[model samples]
Target: MQKEIMSNTLKILCADMVQKANSGHPGAPMGLSDIAVVLSHHLHLNPQDSSWLNRDRLVFSGGHCSALVYSLLHLWGFDVSLEDLKQFRQLGSKTPGHPEFGHTHGVEITTGPLGQGVANAVGFAMASKYAQRILGENVISHFVYCLCGDGDLEEGISYEACSLAGHHQLSNLILIYDSNKITIEGGTEIALSENIARRFEAQGFDVFECDGHNFDSIDLAIKSAKESCKPALIIAHTVIGKNAVGVEGSHKTHGAPLGAEVVAASKEFMGFEKDQAFVIAQEVKSAFEASIAKGMSECEKWKKSLSQEVQSKIAELQNPDFSQVQYPAFKQGDKVATRVSNGEILNAIARSYSGLVGGSADLGPSNNTLLKNEGDFPKGRNLHFGVREHAMGAICNGIANYGLFLPYCATFFVFSDYMAPSVRVASIMKTQVMYVWTHDSIGVGEDGATHQPIEQLSHFRAMPNLLVFRPADANENIACMQVALEMKAPSAFVLSRQNLEVLSPVSKDQVQKGAYVILESENPDVILLATGSEVNLALKGAEMLKNQGKSVRVVSMPCMELFSQQDQAYQDSILSNRNKTIAIEASRGMEWYRYAKVVIGMDSFGASGKGDDLFVFFKISVEEIVKKAQEI
Candidate 1:
């Protein structure tokens, strides 16, 4: 009876929050209330220690059900209050329309875009496995639970992430699918028809079914799921708006509030006074208090029983010291592709820091991202993410959020489009994920226009909070990697497939500022700015112009994002008044206008040929750069 009242209280609060806002979804929370009640009772959470390392993670994959999560957090006493519930969906409120990870105390990850949370949960599960392997099960053992809806399963990314989870045998991960058979538009039967259990079984998941509203059935299914040798999926059959007075089980109840009269009648029917709102019975409060006290006791026991070695490991994982990291040095004039340099630096970092873990999207060799000799992940440091770029990105974010690892994902620069959404989420959440993107330009050669990336650099540079680096040579690549490691936000290293000459007298400190004059000419007539492969062309063009008695300065602007963040004084120092300033790169040059008077770059797709031939054809060569400089 107490459990039933607690479930009803959750539903009433969710309905009231949404109705007061006159916006937001109320159906899933109402339908999933009973499951939430059961899960809340069983979840290993300590409200007093919300950041406890071994605590189980819960992701609301169907994030429109934010009301339910907020209500549960409030009831469980995690800083969310009755006033916070009243302020749902309002501007600057802790209770935003969608659950934002860092913005809320217990929200795991910023989830709103359909299937991202599911993918993130997979990542969280993967991180847990990795942590357990390193720290031992006694120190780190927990489950990753996600509440997803039909729309989450319908999205393609969920399939990608879930497939990887099954392949890895992440038995610690459990997905509770609220099979309410409804979407905002109408019944899910209109679009979805696949047997979900069969699909999951095919993906190597232990599948189970239960009545969502029945606490005993939900508990039994979860118990069986925990004992599985493979990842598990519990399909909890439910009715949309399960207990609403008039609109129960109807599609109209999916996104809108039950009218005030319906809400009052529903409360009355649930044995609550119709006149009151946000009311929690005393028994529900006692039940939560008992659970919280038990969790606190468990947390205290875990802390007391931890060995000194395990405690040290935990401390190191949480706070990594990168200041003493010694980076490998590069010789000037060495003909090395930035991708190869990136691989060398990655291995060096992995050797020094156990927290560095990630893999390419099945492009390790080409992207040069493998941590050589570091076995496979969960046992080895390297992760082979197969060809799933989208899942790989979210998985990296998950690992980063796990608070022990610095995660990175790699792919060809052109394929960044496949992972852009996840990358955006990382930026939004300020997760310190690194993206190693190789084959950064038309220099991809005979692979042709389809394989080369012309606008990707500009697209990423435009995104806020993302540090985009296009290192000119080996040394700059190392410097970019160093900066990425130290940065609090996400970073991407756009590396080259073709070898570049290691520029003489490289300044790692200057590169940290984003752009630096590689070769400064006294009394400069023209300032030539470039990045990646074009930096060498800019240098050669500067020499040619200098031979013609025109003093020219060459600047390697490897990271536009970092450069833009510099103070106006520093920017002016590098981009001071000159007779003419020209920017050269192999992609669309519009972004260069902020620092240069003329932009020399590709305005069309590349042709299939030798990389050098394509560079000449695209007029991104030394000769063309000189000609343009002469014209200027």
Candidate 2:
């Protein structure tokens, strides 16, 4: 009876929040209230220390249900208060329309786009397995619970991520599907017809079903999922609006609020005073408080029993000591592809930082991202993410949330489109996941336009909180890697497939600052700006212009994002005072106009041919650059 009251209280709180805000979803939360009651009361979590390492993670994959999440957080005595709930969907409220990861105390990952949270939960589960292998089960053992709806399963990323979870045998992961038949358009039967349980079973999940509003049925389903040897999915069959009087089971309640009269009547139907709003019975509050206290006690006991090695590992993950890291050295004039250089630097760093783990999206060998001789992850240091680029990115974000792992995912630069959504989320959350994107231009050769990246660099550069690096050569690649490791935000290292000449007298610190003068002449007539493969062309062009008695300066601008962040004075020092500035790259040149008078780059897709032939054909060669500089 007390549990039923608490579930009703949650439904009322959700309805009140959405109705007061005059916007937001209420139907799913109302339907899923009983399940939330069971999970919040049964899940092991520390409200006092929300960042506790071993605490179970609960993700609201159907993030429109944010009101219920906020209510649960407030009930569990996290920093979310009643006032915060009242401010739902308002500007600057902690209780935003969607649950943002870092913005909320107990929120695990920023999830709003359907299926991302499902993939993120898979990542969290993977991290748990890896952490347990390194830190021991007693130290890192915990389950990852996710509450998703039909929309989540409808999205493709969930399928990719869940398949990987099953393949890895992530038994610690449990997904609760709120099988509410309604979407904003209407019933899910309008579009979806696949048997969800059979689909999951095909994906290697242990599937179960239950009455979503029945406490005992929900409890039994959860328990059975916990005992499964594979990743589990509990399909909680439910009404759209479980208990609302006028709108119960109606698609109208899916997004809009139940009107004031309907809400009052719904409260009365649930055995509460018709006019009462956000009312919590004393017994309901006491149950949550008791559960919270028990969680805190368990956390304390676990912390006390942790071994010194586990403690040290935790400390190391939180505050990595890169001072002892010996970065690989590259000699000047070495003909090395930046991708190969990345592989070398990555291996060197991985050898020292046990927390550094990642894999390519089945392009490990080609992307040069493998951690040499470290083997595959769990028992080894490498991660084999297979061909699933989208899931690989979200999984890396999940590992980043673990607070002890510096995760990275790799793919060809062109395929970044496949993972762009996850990358955007990582940037929004400020997770320090590195993306190693190789084959970063039309220089990909014979593979043709489809495989070569023309606009990807600029696309990523435009995204806020993402550090995009296109290193010129071997030494610059190392410098980019160092900056990526130290950055608090997510970063992408766009590397070249073709070999580049290691420039003489490279300055690692200058590269870290985003750009530096690689070749300078006194009182230059033109400033030549370039990045990646084009930097070599810029130098050669500068020499050619100098031979024609025009003083020229060549600058390697490897990271436009970093350059833009530098102080105005420093930016002016590199960009100002030239008679004419020309920017040269192999992709779209529009982004370069800020620093240059003329921009030389591709405006169309590349053709299949030798890389050198394609470079000249696209007019990104030294001779073309020299000609363009002369014309300027």
lDDT of each structure?
Answer: 0.88, 0.88
- Which ten residues in a row are the worst by lDDT in model 1? 288-297
Model 2: lDDT of residue 136: 89
TM-scores across all candidates? 0.97, 0.98
lDDT of 2 at 83: 92
lDDT of 1 by residue, 28-101 (tens): 89999999888876688888898888888999998899999899888888889889999999998989998997
lDDT of 2 by residue, 288-407 (tens): 777557678889999999888779878987888766678777888889999998999888888788888999999998999888887786687688988899888888888899778888
After TM-score superposition, what is the CA distance of residue 581 in candidate 1 from its true location, in Å? 1.8
Model 2 reaches what TM-score against the true structure?
0.98
Cα lDDT for residue 121, model 1?
Answer: 96
For candidate 2, the C-alpha RMSD (Å) to the true structure equals 1.3
